[model samples]
Target: MKKNVFYVLMLFFVFTACNREDMQNNPGNIEVVQKDPLTAKEINEKINETIKTKGRFSWKESSDHFIWSTIFQGNKIASIGFGSSFDRNLDSNNKAIEAEILKVIEQYEGKTERILLSSDQYLNQIDVAIEKQETVIALRKMKNIRYLEPADYRYFENEQKLGKSSSGSSGCGFESTALSASDYTTVTPNAKAPWSFTKHNIINAWSYSSGAGVTIGVIDSGVSPEQTLLGSSFNNGLSSGRTISKNGVYVDSIWPWSTGYDGPNDQCGHGTSMASAAAAPRNNQGQPVGVAYNSNLVTYRAASNVVLDGYHEQNGVKIAFTELGNNNNVKIISMSMGHIFSVGKIEDGVKYAYSKGKLIFCAGGTSTSFTNFVGVIFPAWMSETQAITGVKENTSNQKCDVCHSGAEIDFTYQMERASGNSIPVLSYYNGQTDYVGGSSVATASTAGIAALVWSKNPTWTRDQVLNKMRQSATYYPTPNSDYGYGNINVLQAVQ
Candidate 1:
């Protein structure tokens, strides 16, 4: 009887050890530990700490638990991307991969309903709830899984919830300031030409080409419906035979599956200024004129503000880029908005646009609430984009007080006046003008110059036009450490 009991005990121990080994290998049945949400201050501190130690911060390297704790506090949903961003042929295969991923989630969570919140139509990305860390670990090990990050993380919203006032400082404002007479000079037809036009000799370039044949796509807040200069009056005065189209892709909801798109209108004043500075008509009604006054314009309301901190903002930008990329008429694409770090979807969108032969320009960076430590922001820091920043008049090395400069900066625009003023643009309202400064206006102005170059050489490829612009810039053979190729001489470029 004792010998039989000993044999039975050994068999029980052997079975228990086998079960433990299976659990270690699979991890699908393991329970995930829940942690409390992090405060806004804590989130900022963690990001800063990562930047200090890692030289750069990426959501790809962060753990799934940390991302959930910091970003998806109330909801446990996570955004994920699979397949190569550069592979255009992976769309068909992505569906099968997505199915396999869903199966893995079902195995871990023991559920099959409502596991997928949303999936992108163009790119290989999806949004789903991740209740277990083991699911994240399994997803990471899967083939072609690019990234997993928070889809609806809004830093400024969290700050506001904490009773912090962030007005006029987050680069988001609806107030339009009155412009001074000194800010512009009266051109033909009683139009107000921005003072920076003389600094860059854009007036001379107009004699060669007014960006007549090229179309510029401005991805920003939607063009203001109140500003008639960008609407019905777009073809008045010297600017005629061109068109302006406005699009809105921004979704004003936290839900990724929401289909309601905010209409094509400038709820924020920033987009109106950017549009005016790039392609506002040179009308006879004493309104401010754009650099490429005759260039066709297509503006998109891609985000609520200049800062891209939420899922909808980033998603809208991606959609805008893809749409602009497919538009054969669009030769140049400009965006004055960006995030402090790289967002995977945005990166993929930019690459797609670039692949379609669109000359893309992005803002180097403007001063923000917590981005003082950051350099050139993404997607400006990307190689596929030409990074532009604001420089003071009469000097290429001196940047504007609110603009950022770094090695990634590819060009500079003389937008900052000596008298503490900025570039003059048509106001969001009719019959008025406002002054816009920083890298935002600079990038748009650069895009206008590119339009002029492309218009002059209509048959030239995108690289040929870019090369001509580069050869005509201040520093051509060797670029500056902080300001790449310096400022482009618009007159020389058009010639």
Candidate 2:
């Protein structure tokens, strides 16, 4: 009878050990209590609530489980940020983290096959499929994992599908307008200088430096091929000895695994105006001239629209920043595109470029159809970039009707005209001009002015150039609560 009892005890212990191993390996079988997925309305409401309570919303501050349930609706894919935040030298360490994450994923999903959708070569970020909620819980507990956000959550697209009104600030246009004589002054070679040029003293600044030696990298929609001045005729008339290159990093697909890249061409009209506002060639075609007419140009088609509302758009921006950061010739990086809240990969990309000593400029928020309650907006709100917004003519304190302003605004541009016009830029098509307004043109024009300053003081560090600009601005030594240093006097900045 004692021997029989010993055999039964051994069987019981063996069965318990087997059950424990199975539970550890297969977390899906451990009876997880799942919550209902949040609706679009609920998600937006939560975001507003958070913003009201915290004064701002950041994915980094939110819990990993909430991010999965709300933004992603328990979507299978998640963006993983590992290693130290903004650590440029964590490449090898990141690889190790990637391995560990994959191991954890395998333990939960019970599959060893490749699950990583995409991994950034430079930034310590990866996109992977997490089948079980337990996996998210476990990953959050890991010391090396910094953040886990939905990799493919597209807020604007989802909103549209749900029959919401289109965001008023899509920043997509193709129409070209005629230049009114009252809006411009005739310059040499029959070129037209925008009236705002005189308001900011950019014409006077030209005598000092036309951004001849500096290269400005535009991270926006690509320049139009039909606009010859930005292309084969880039060196026409007085704008000589400068090169313009076009690149495309935007993927046309929503799938994270899509490898096809849309070519370097501006599908949206916003990019063309931005490029024209910054560095359109000074030519004899009776066209509107740019701020840095003689500056070298490098434009990237990084997104479908100025509103970064989709997965591919965000990914494209990340790729553009990294590539521009690696480029030795790029001195200033300008992006008039942004999101209402911070994106982890984009933050990483901006930090990478900033670390490479590239002077960056981003647009302050512009009023959108959905909401305008946001302040400076992501990337611009970050300290690494100089945020610019549009202001009414001759008034630094008053912002344009559609432009957003806050304490984060670094500078204001005289973009809005008394006649209800904005800055005149070369149209997407050749031999045409268009009016672009809000903070988009403001940011680009400011970038052009920076190019001029950097060109004049070629040996100056980024800080030196920035300091000079601040000192030369309308409000120096002290900043306004709404606008930082206020309007920049281009001539004074270049000098």
In model 2, which regions exceed 4 Å deviation? 1-31, 85-92, 162-164
Candidate 1 off by > 4 Å: 1-40, 53-55, 86-92, 159-165
Steric clash pairs (candidate 1): none
TM accuracy, model 1? 0.91
Give the best candidate by lDDT.
Answer: 2
Q: What is the Å distance of residue 455 in model 1 from its true position?
A: 0.2
Local distance difference test, each candidate = 0.83, 0.85
The deviation in Å at residue 40 for candidate 2 is 2.8
Q: State the TM-score for model 2.
A: 0.92
Clashes of each: 0, 1
Best by TM-score, which number?
2
